[model samples]
Target: MIEAISTETTKFRHATVGRTGTALLGIGIALLAAVMPLAAQSGDPRMLDKLGEAGERSWDGLLSGAAQITGAGGLLGFGVVLGWMFGREFVDGTITGLFGLPVSRAQIAAAKLIVYLAWAVLVSALIVGALIVGGLALGLGLPPTDTAGGLARQFALGVMTALVALPVAWVATVGRSVLIGVVGAIGLVIAAQVATIGGAGGWFTVAAPALWALSEGDDVSGLQLALLAPLLILVVGVTLHAWRTLQLNR
Candidate 1:
């Protein structure tokens, strides 16, 4: 298993798609975070409704909006990476080569998933670091009393958001297509938005992390957050099964 993980980690280091996606994710969030404050200060009517600020235009609202990016934009970015990692083997006609390896196919798949999750953590940190730099560039003044907690929530939210994307691994492996998994990830995001609007965001694991990050409105419970464990386990199990039982004919 360690060898399998090491091999997957090596492949990840050189994966072009993964690197591009991570770059885009970081740039997109930084731009969005920077713009939020500028737009509000510029009197953009769209920023008039900055939540929790009630109309005063404060740093909390500015920072919170940036943090929420992890929940939404991060989801799609994570999906793209997951799609490429799991689906690339079949797409590159390299799945057949796995048969010669001493490690079980399932072990290889598990290793890939593990490596991806570890990558997710690093991606989340980069995102949060970018946010801080953006905030500093804008001279947001001294950090607010709650700034540290808010950033912490955003960091954890970034990771949890990526975790919720695990099902895309299952989709990619089963469909043997990176595009399919990416579509699945998009569908999941859309569904999360709708569920949040419908007031079920707290109970919906997909929407819970975002709401938690903002720390305002959409109450999430300990029980609801706890549900992520089983969902992830199921996704990982199904994805491993798909890899183990892969059919060359398909």
Candidate 2:
């Protein structure tokens, strides 16, 4: 396990598996969070009204826009990372090398997942931290006391969004192409949008976390969040199986 983990970590350091894309994603989210409030507060009442934020407080608008961007962008960003993590080996024509490693394929896959879990947590924190810094830079003033809970939910939303991207790894591994995994990620996003529009967002795992975050814990039930556990376990289990019994022909 240690060896596998080390090897995967090394690959991340030197490989070209969507790091540029991830960097651009982070920048995009940060920039959007930074500018969205300014746009909302455009100083023209007519413009603010057109944005549907007329008469809203600046801080509230900033926080709300930041949260919305985080919920949506975080999913696609994490998907890019996860898709590359699991499928890069094949894309780079290096998967065959992994077959001969002393470490088991399952261990290698598990190591990738473990690394992703840690990365997800770190990325989630960074997203919130970036927003706070952005808010302060804009002189939005001290956030309201109620803002703490909303921020916490946003942070949780980031991690949950990453977890929701896990199945992209499975899709990548099964399909043996990073493009396939990314397409799967886009599919999930579309499905979530449709599910949310249909009012089943609470019951749908992919849609629930974002909805909960956006609603500030008012909409989605605890049962919906808990349901994510089994789905994740199933995904990871099948992913490991795919690696453990991997064959070249497929």
Candidate 3:
């Protein structure tokens, strides 16, 4: 029994290390791309040249460059990476091997959740850092004042972005298929975007972290907090669901 638990724990740790490596790779790419925008935009330019005549237009190179550099949709990219990590286990039949072990299903699930949360935090930090640095280089300027409130909002953005993984993890465990889980995560992000466009109520923000980041400003209102409440609820639900699913087989 002790050996079984140790083996399962080791597998979980191994999967986490692999995912961390991928997260670092993404960060490295972001770092390299960060310098491209500054170099492209550092030239003498007539602000009022003919509408079409341009030496180095913002749209031509820097805008797209900044987008890629910032890794704006990086959380979604991490979701795909996480899905692939679990998918490997399924492909190698290691998931089945785990079930045959003496560890409680809950322990197995909890281990995965720990890895998931760690991945989310690490990737979110990388993406946020990239965005801040890229934004400064592109002349957006540092966030105003960097006050406590500003810092809080910034930290919240990272946390909310990371929260996305809870649902992804839940879907992965329940479906037992990485492909389905990844597709589901992509669908959820799309649906959140649509909900914002359609003027849906705050409920949409329950699962959408980007919503909070996009909404933050000097004039942010109480209604914004109301919106975040549901997102908190959604996070709790996903965490509970994952726990229950793991406990079932135990």
* Best TM-score among the predictions, by candidate number: 1
lDDT of 2 by residue, 1-250 (tens): 9888887778775766545644544455655767765676568777666555312446556556655766667777788778889888898899999888888899999999988887777766776677677678877776678778766876788788889889999999998998998888888888888998999999999889988876777899999999899999999999999999999876
Q: For model 3, what is the C-alpha lDDT against the true structure? A: 0.51
Assess candidate 1 and give its TM-score to the true structure.
Answer: 0.92
Pick by TM-score: 1 or 3, better one: 1
lDDT of 1 at 191: 89
Query: TM-scores, in order shown?
Result: 0.92, 0.90, 0.61
- Candidate number that wins on TM-score, 1 or 2: 1
Task: Check candidate 3 and list the clashing pairs.
Answer: 206-231
Clashes of each: 0, 0, 1
Better of 1 and 2 by lDDT: 1
lDDT of 1 by residue, 1-250 (tens): 9999999999988888778877877666766766765666667666656633422334575567666676788898898899889888888899999988899999999999999989888877887778777777777766677777777777788789889999999998888888888899998899899999999888899989888776653477778889999999898889888888877887
Model 2: how far residue 39 lies from native, Å:
1.6
- Candidate that scores best on lDDT: 1
Candidate 3: regions farther than 4 A off? 1-72, 85-88, 131-144, 147-152, 206-208, 217-250
Query: Residue-wise lDDT of candidate 3 within 206-240, one digit each (tens)?
Result: 33444444444422345654666565567556644
lDDT of candidates 1 onward, in order: 0.81, 0.78, 0.51
Q: RMSD of model 3, in Å? A: 6.9
